[model samples]
Target: MNTAAQPPVGEKVRCLACGEVFDASISVCPVCGASGEWLALYVPETNAFRRESEEIFLIVGGGIAAVSAAEAIRERNRLCSIVLFSEEAVLPYNRPMLTKAMFDSLAEEALAIHPRSWYEEHGIYLMLSKRVVSLLPEERELVTDDGAHFHYDKCILATGASCFIPPIEGTGLAGVVAIRSVTDAAAAARRAEAGQNAVVIGGGVLGLEAAWALKKAGCHVTVLENSPRLMMRNLDAAASALLQAAVEESGVAVVYSAQTDKINGTETVESVTLRDGTVLPADLVVVSCGVRANTALAQSAGIETGRAVVVDEHMETNLRGVYACGDCAEFRGVNRAVWPVAAEMGACAGANAAGEAAVYAEHPVPFTF
Candidate 1:
């Protein structure tokens, strides 16, 4: 039941896990290693921060999907009131760069997809650090975490998926992390010390990229993939083997069919134990299994969801004025959870919402090892 605001710039934020208070300047709790998401933000006593919105088009989420949809809507209708809500405090950036450039010191300006001025120029109201807590499709109303209600002519549920961390023992340790957002990458970077042992669970693209980042940061990296082959969803056995060899050549050990039973450590991760009694020493563990579509808000409002929010070719949900797109939506029983697919879906949803005829066709792009 925690709200979005808390831990103001200089205030002490309390950690829900361990009740430890720390400065808001640090995104992660130094006492228990919990990320900023677990810590509450500081909110003032006044209701001045409460936003009253009646946008013509309301988009939930600030990722690429939401941005694309906003642009499409504006392209179709210039004077439409478009409001975008983002759970993160910053502007939408290239999310893929978080893994690709983890070792590099990237400025916020470099990571942003569109500068702050760009949103204003395009007439898109970007509400940062705000989460839509509930959706009332019956009333065409949306409620944010801060208790602000908004009515929209049409709404897009583009809330993206979050990193899925398996229920593994010792995962709460200080060195354990996930590389999902810029904040996550920064937390992982802070722990990737020289000569440290880093274990990356799941040999998917995100995991491999994280392992490479740690390797470049001078950490001895090992990739543990539970399946018999790495990137099993996309790569064949031969391609998987070739990719494993290349990763090994870069001084990273790739282990297949490795079931991690537990992360062995008291407070900080010391090593990882496999099901076969094999133990790999580790100072950091990055879990990059996959993502679960963010469908809680839609489901709470009685929207049908099976793995993801159900949508038609027009990207409209069961409700007349509500639409869903990106990773949070499924069409004809298929949910293509990739950047390219998300962009296409966003465009289709935006166009159709703006009274234009648009249909989302499946774009099949095979995964490359």
Candidate 2:
């Protein structure tokens, strides 16, 4: 049941044209499109892993996906060694709360998934403030930003996405920001003071949430949406109109069908100019367009990727002994950047990595913001 790395599974399959090592099962090299004999397999001896030695499962990322994966792995095999590398200094916490309740006076410890002692008690190694730089799939190794090298029998990538800042001028101004991390939330809270003007770009969930937060902070808030309606992906015209009305009743202004040409000011941002020649005055602006998957590490390892890392039903990547989940992974060419989907994928990936049988089927239900 344990889908551990076996002979030829974790081996290097090189492309004759690109000279890149990809998955053997891939008939054509994902990089150069070489087919047939052009793809060659090379399996090495399993001397690196002794039967008596304990197996190690390495997870790169520090989000819901990574935390869920660790829990799933522990549930399957208590004796196996597990190391979770997180780029953030803090422990995993409720990410959604960062924007949803930015103004709420939440204590630092309250954000964590569990107390620091939980990982120790569960025998999970939590490596905080560590960023994995490169992946050597052929050697089953990963190198951290600090020059630390780690070897693993099975590895899972939960490297979550980053905010997508559009190509808008004046983003480098003093008050412009994106509410993605805890630190960002703190900054926004400090800036969104009473008597100040704030504009939020993008009418998505985060944008609307941020607008609400700023409004709650006693600032005059305006939401600029490029689309015709708010939450267009989730709500139809009628629903969007109702939601917009509700939001406006809360003392927030909504602008729709807007095309931002530039954010202008002498020093700090003073106004946002739309393509239609209308200008909105603002002291601060928050951009909440969307997010892009962190696929640089996976791509460097020759792992097949589209918008996100591609995975099979077992949550395993094309490369054997490797798996990917969360916003950073694409299933059947679609990436669902929602928390529920990420957690499900992570659980399936972790269970399979621990030699437990678990299959991941995409959620049939539709998502709404």
Stretches of candidate 2 above 4 Å error? Answer: 1-53, 365-369
Candidate 1 C-alpha lDDT tens digits along 41-149: 5442321122223348999998878988987787777767999999998898767678878877556766776789989999999999999999887778889999999
In candidate 2, the residue pairs with backbone N, CA or C atoms under 3 Å apart (3 or more residues apart, or in different chains) clash, namely 2-355
Tell me how far the alpha carbon of residue 228 in candidate 1 is from the true structure, in angstroms, after superposition: 2.5
lDDT of 2 by residue, 166-256 (tens): 9999998878989877888888887888989999999888898899889988999999999888888888899988998999899989889
Root-mean-square deviation of candidate 1: 13.7
